[model samples]
Target chain A: MKGITVRSPARAAELFHALADPTRLEILDELKEGECCVCELTDRLQAGQSRLSFHLKVLKGAGMIVDRREGRWMYYSVNAEALAELDDLVDSLKQAKRARRATGCC
Target chain B: MKGITVRSPARAAELFHALADPTRLEILDELKEGECCVCELTDRLQAGQSRLSFHLKVLKGAGMIVDRREGRWMYYSVNAEALAELDDLVDSLKQAKRARRATGCC
Candidate 1:
């Protein structure tokens, strides 16, 4: 089994922190359907434009999501690499559990 | 592809919030070796007892780690179930990314 390694605890924490919000999770869910413009997300999420923008910024800052400006609209989609990294982080915890169980250390 | 379903955004956020701390991640790393008593964790992480306790509490509260009382000591270990759940959450995002790319939604 591959060992779980968090080379940068700060970076992992930042990624998790970006995921620690209901609004942001909703945004991610919305974006998961496909690239969405700001107006579409605001309507779908029923979030105020400013509030939605803040969550988008947080997700983008964490590299969890990517955005592109198309003329007047900004489109957003989930970043697959970041999600894979987060998956690896969770796998690390699972690996630790396996190691502890195997060693049965007390 | 299995769709990503966030049944409860609040609960997901709570779990992610528990993991959004560098100290807590460090603690998880230590426990990955095996079950650890409070004193051992304090020494290994170089964290004061109170601070450590706070992080432990958060992890425990979110079901990220489990504790057992053994006479005068409390041992901690990672919760495999919670980690699995977190992994699934991350997978959901990945699935979404795939869906978006497959459809090429704009």
Candidate 2:
């Protein structure tokens, strides 16, 4: 298991913000199956190219997904490292919850 | 470890949305230490009472935090079950990433 490296609350908030949208999460779900071309994402998500592109940009900006160019097409896939980082963030929160419970503070 | 029960992307998005704000994350950070009165959170986070209350409502609405009223004071703390559910959500994504990698898909 990777050691949890707690992120600053602001950084965590940024990452969570990126994940907070239904459209972006849908795009991620598509890419999770495998790398997908922009055309495929637009078709599968039933979103306009411009609309999908906007969400893609947000995911890419947050380091949640990575993109590559293949000739005229753009391919995207989930960033494994980002998912690992998210796991760490959750672990840190869980640890905090446990610590709080240990104190038995009301 | 608890088994991962995957949440729909929309549901995941809703939870993440509640966590997307820096102020909400800061409030969670303070509560992670132990349950705190609303007045203490307002003082520690340097947020106006109404503003802090708004964030608290969002957190509570998403089931991320629990609140209790004692006399005239309201107290807040992290919800351990919600953290566990978030852990599961991350686990599902990690599993997807692994599955994608195993397929050797570009």
Candidate 3:
């Protein structure tokens, strides 16, 4: 919600829907720095493991996060490929903002 | 999936989940040029009205798209704020890529 504008209005709603939840957004903001173990995430998020697990799983299933097992702990990180797609997603917002200058959309 | 990378791994999953569908992604891609009517989308996507409407509704609910009604036709565009957030999302991916260079995640 910083620099990019809406380029693809149709998909904007659905895109934001994934981020509309406070818990999910918070979880994502937390992961901005780097990968964290479930325990650390739980402490940082102040969320129960059950909830954290669910959120983490959602992120993972979306191909947003990937994990590596270290002994009994699992470490997770973001998917670069998906991230790039997101960049394009945000670019649509930028285009939409510019669309205001052009009224030729069909 | 171009320039941006994942910034928030956890959120990445949630974000991508919002866009994982071919329909949703296609819708977003189509709108990238500018606002388009359901008719145009329907034509471009070669999908039925019911399905297009359903997909459009989903994108709107997700905050990816905003609509303006012109007589009977509905015109939709993307939201820039959400796109910026997406840029940040992709940044996490760039970081993750860099993180690969440094193995000090806690």
Interface Cα RMSD, each model = 3.2, 3.9, 7.6
B1-106: candidate 2 lDDT, tens digit per residue: 4323345877899899988988988887777777888888877778999999999999999999998988888888889888887877776666543343443222
- lDDT agreement of model 3 with the native: 0.64
For lDDT, candidate 1 versus 3, the one ahead is 1
Alpha-carbon deviation at B101 in model 3, angstroms: 19
Q: Which candidate number has the best lDDT? A: 1
Worst 10 residues of 2 chain B by lDDT: B97-106
Give per-residue CA lDDT, model 3, range A65-93, as digits (tens).
67888877888766665566566665543
Candidate 1 structure quality by residue, lDDT tens digits, B13-91: 9999998999999998888867888888888888999999999999999999999988888989888888788877887
Once fitted onto the true fold, the runs of candidate 2 whose alpha carbons sit more than 4 angstroms away are A1-6, A97-106, B1-6, B97-106
In the range A56-77, model 2's lDDT, one tens digit per residue, is 9999999999999878888898
User: lDDT (0-100) at residue A49 of candidate 3?
Assistant: 88
Can you tell me which runs of candidate 1 are displaced by over 4 Å? A1-3, A96-106, B96-106
Clashes by residue pair, model 1: none
lDDT of 1 by residue, A1-106 (tens): 5666677899999999999999999898888877888998888889999999999999999999999988888988888889888877877766634444443333
Error of 3 at B2 (Å): 28
TM-score of each: 0.89, 0.85, 0.58
Residue A92's lDDT within candidate 1 is: 72
The DockQ-based CAPRI class assigned to model 1 is medium
